[model samples]
Target: MTILAIGAAGIAAVLLAVWLKGVRAEYAVYLVMAAEILFMLSAAGRLEVILDAMERMRGYIRVDSAYLGTLLKMIGITYVAEFASGICRDAGYGALGNQIQILGKLSVLGVSMPVFLALFETLERFMK
Candidate 1:
């Protein structure tokens, strides 16, 4: 769909949710699900742009593939965790959302640890 169509659809969904809130409010859950589906569909279309940019930049940078891969993994994990947490919050599970955020932070640290250790190891060798 074009940007205008997507925006119109989102606005209509939000209005429907608002109306549903005053009636059978629980049914509004479907609105949230639909919105997320639309967002994910649009994101799927843009994924190639991100990968293409990454690939184009690879020729100009001398960074190790391991570090680049780890960076991408961390970014992907962060986005996924945030999206999941938002859904949890929408479902009234604030505690679960918080837990998801904490796990995401830990996961990002875990992913970057190897690169950190490698950097320090290289520094140690250089100093000796």
Candidate 2:
């Protein structure tokens, strides 16, 4: 599993970082960041595979593509927000991390607005 591989690598790197702390702390930090980035890339690769499979199903289904696209956008915002916040936190920028989370919330709300509008419009038409 990718998570297992990452966990093993993380353990080893943590040990190495501990050993390097007294000699070269900056290099240790860089090593840790590199590992984090590698894991992130692996996750993204897996997510892409899933998304591609879903895209393939589009031809067989009569789905609302716009809603699907918006849902995907919301998913992206969630992940990107988490990623940005993690980076900020790791870099010792607490305020920046908070801001990133706020931005993510706003992004989700923005992406969902069209769905909300459609729902309300449908209700209005039914009432009439």
Flag regions of model 2 displaced more than 4 Å.
56-61, 123-128
CA lDDT scores, all candidates in order: 0.85, 0.84
Among residues 3 or more apart in sequence or in different chains, the pairs in candidate 1 whose N, CA or C atoms overlap within 3 Å are none
TM-score of 2: 0.78
Against the true structure, what is each candidate's TM-score? Answer: 0.83, 0.78
**Quick one: RMSD of model 1?**
2.3
Q: What is the model-wide C-alpha lDDT for candidate 1?
A: 0.85
Query: lDDT tens string, model 2, 22-117?
Result: 899877777777777877787788887868866877878966789778878998899889888877776668899999999999999999999889
What does candidate 1 score on TM? 0.83
